[model samples]
Target chain A: MAHSGINLIFEGQNLPRLLGGLWITIRVALIAIIAGGVLGIFLGVLRTFKNRFLRFILRLYLEFFRIVPTVVLLFLFYYILPKSMNLNLPAAEVATLVFTLWMAAEASDIVRGALISVPQHQVDSGLAIGLNRSQLYYYVLIPQSLKLMLPAMMNLISRIIKTTSLLLLISVLDVINVGQQIIEANQKQYPQGAFWVYGVIFVLYFLICYPFSLLAKKLQKD
Target chain B: MSWQIIQQSLPMFQKGFILTLQMSALGILGAIILGLMCSLCQYFKIPVLKQIVGAYIELSRNTPLLIQLFFIYYGLPGIGLKLSAYTCGIIGLIFLGGSYMAEGFSGGFDGIPNSQIESGKAIGLSQGQLTRYVVFPQGFALSIPALAANIIFLIKETSIFTVIAIPELTNTALDLIGLYYHTNEYLLVLVVGYAIILIPLSIILTWLERRIRYGTFGD
Candidate 1:
């Protein structure tokens, strides 16, 4: 057929635009991962400390994130926060903030679990060797916990990437959003464009996430 | 911010809340059935089917429900599969949740010891009888925690149903906000509605898990 649907995806600059949209998704996920990773590791270490009140508050923070859906959080930030706080921010920024907060909450728990899973006797030995608390953690606990947490962290990265699809809801111009735009623009000419467009979006997401998941599985087995 | 606006919107929110619950209940049921089928395929080592299940799990696990919904709601119509938004929402949930539940159930299936199977065989129980009595119970009990988590997760995921124009809680709130610009009030009620449903469900699930664990494994 002269006006076949799949051709619309490659018609002129559509594919490049979609790739650009994918870049936006990747950029947001990367910022969140780096910032959230550092913050989460700190919070996780603090979680294992013997401070009862701090641990209680951290528990509440984690619970809040867990109980609330990410889409709700995204809406809260993207819609309500700007008006309530009377501060203008970009949708992409709001997305980054929400995902970073969500990532921090999840990553902290993973970190806490990894940290605590390390044998207590090792900690005791580190302390028994005239090592300061910071030294003990830096030299002994952090290294051990890193190995335990990496796979979970990789899984979390994929999750953050997948959940970035929700960015389309907040008008973040992600790949899904771009695909919609393409479908709408070509709707008159190519009635069946949506299937190929969304199908491509699906494959794009699968490509990005599959490797992280596979890596997680491999590391988990190790 | 206005109490009157919030009060007026309560009915809309309530209707949406009920829809959310209804959709999630159906989705969860379908997911359990589908997940059980997948787990059974793996448990029995059904040649080609096992490999297909493995691939399906990986594919579904890696993609977000939002894309899957768009593909079905907007895309499938292209290939002559025009389902309603409601049907598509439930289908998407089942497709996504089924994989997760399958993983959870497979974990349970794997946890069932070979010794138990051997013991069942020693008593001359057929494979079907052993699966019904020895395996299903223990595996299901072991899977309670995971299954509960998946249920809660599926419910939370229902929020994205708004994207396809389903009048769920989030959709209702956004609609009210678009109309009245009462973002503050609607958002508050939306959060409260979800908290009311999810928090109690989580607590009750935790309690149920404890009860089941005690009944099955018995400390």
Candidate 2:
């Protein structure tokens, strides 16, 4: 009846439990991407403002967050911020916030790349047709760049899902954390459950991400 | 933020900085060799090996470096294969960085037109000579910017080693908080520490990108 005696995943209900953990991972990753995408679009558009001071301010903001390590950012939000402000925030909130900040920086890069790449000749042609700045961007520029932007964002979707694995570090009960807990609980019976558990975790993640990665490649070719 | 705080921790910061440098240097060295081998495997249509290399690239590229780190650092030990935390961290980073580098080389290979390869063959060069004289030089030029960018990313990634408590820059900052009891100050110091190292490298990357774009390194 057994598939194999050395089957890596647990024999019974643990497979279902592990799937539940993966579901949490998928949920958190989706929320972070959506939130980050929205914020990133705004920041990206804001970065295009003509005023030097505003651009300087945004550049500093985006650059600072971009350079800082994500784990350090995680600690700042999950540990130090709560302790410093004496206001308790849940680990999920911290993970989401850190990821959102990270995604915003990345997304803004995508947006800026898209916007900048709209050829000046195209803009000049739009101007010749009496289109205003908004119309020029709305009708012509964004459409051209949107093709480029979408594929990059698709790449980020997988990136977001992969990154959610880091939630384990902050003690958020994501798939990796759940897998770790399962291993810890059953260490006596299966000391090497880690090999199996983490292997399965890798497969779960690979299944989710590889498709998006392939799609991004396909879109880039298009 | 404090001068005294910064002054007293300079030595400790240097040690951490050196470790970060060592890690990146080793990682880039390993990645170059691994990336070249993988790219050559792809270029030559090495059958099953090519498929394996492609899968490795996808798996390494798509997964989070931290998850890969956990697998190498923790999961391997469970199977009776153990590496020190530093070694595990570096190996994980090399795989991640190498895959990106390999992909870049593949893209670079794509850029070298089929006509060029045909021309090489038309010249009656041997297969080894064709690959040596034809593929690698142009691909290397095309891949330099990507290599530089991958190196920068790998440098930033060394920060992840902090989670495994390897005393890299970010970890050193964490350790500094223990000594100074000034969390925000060390955070600021860590930013400065990283900036001092990364900003120059990025400038070089930009310059290399321009060089490649402007045909300085071209056929």
Candidate 3:
């Protein structure tokens, strides 16, 4: 062993660096969720439009995002898109873009399902009154849909957090990437250093995702 | 632009494609077995085994597959349990996929009315016999759609193997791009490669779902 034992990876300097990387991971996830949620709502509504052409386009968009793996999307945005378009975007920005695209597609489907799941009688009763299209959606549909959509949306948010780890492939210094770097740098000292490094990353993700999953379950139960 | 380059690279991609398919097949098989066993144990309310399986499901499902792959690939070796990258990838996939599949299967089991089971019991069938004759068939039938969706999900999830240097389709693309940094066609290749596999797989799953729903065994 060239360096100190496995304890060194967690000692004075490395601990704070790991924490800093985790903070970045959390920041990326939070920002992506907020942005993706807003976009998802818009796309979801677009998907449910009465116009066949609009629905077709939205379906195409959703399928495109859903079928392709996020890693491939990240690679495209991070490496190829910038070079082709002559725009030098940061890795975090690219990550946000790819994640938002993914979330929008997934969330749109959830929203559409939630909206359609609202009973037809509710819509008819709203129409039986003098409520206009905007009023009907705003007053009756959206409120009810929100109750159904919220739990699924929470699951999507946690998924976004976990998926942020893929940004490591694009050279982003998220927690996992940072852990990998530390392990590689100290590998000569601690031959099996990855155990602690990646173990810590696993715990960090579990901490973030588990609570949200519980909340989703509770909401679904209610 | 060069057929020569593509021709030379064809074998590498082919090898990768075959490995990807094999890993997926083995992973899917392992997942079905693990998932079925877990579901059965939970369904029967086995004493301590149920709790153990439940914990496994929760721990696996909540974490990302990438970290699990790293843990299995790197962590196992630290404990004197050595596994090749391919074996590690398959094991990781099996654990991850089994957790998800067990949930689906359990959901299917729950969907079966309790009356069905009670009716079986009234006929003087043993618990094992009830599960085999009455519960399992209906549960499997009802779960076809979920199982199909899970299969598609598993296929997409297999792409994570690239990170562990498993030489899957994605890894092949990464290697090609790394080798020929000048060619900006890597993304296009990846898109085409994945689309070729996934589009047909999705279609087949849809068709299977429809067939199962219609209760028409193939003619």
TM-score of 2: 0.90
lDDT of each: 0.92, 0.82, 0.83
Candidate 1 stretches with Cα past 4 Å from truth are A1-3, B122-124, B214-219
Query: Taking the tens digit of each residue's C-alpha lDDT, what string does model 3 give over B139-159?
Result: 887787888878877877788
Among all candidates shown, the one with the greatest TM-score: 1
Query: What would the TM-scores of all predictions be?
Result: 0.96, 0.90, 0.94
Worst 10 residues of 2 chain B by lDDT: B210-219
Of 1 and 2, the candidate ahead on DockQ is 1
Regarding lDDT, does 1 or 3 come out ahead? 1
RMSD of 1: 1.7
Enumerate the candidates' DockQ scores in order: 0.84, 0.59, 0.63
Of all true interface contacts, what fraction is found in model 1? 0.85
Model 1 accuracy (lDDT, Cα): 0.92
Residue B38 lDDT in candidate 1 = 98
Question: Ranking by DockQ, best first?
Answer: 1, 3, 2
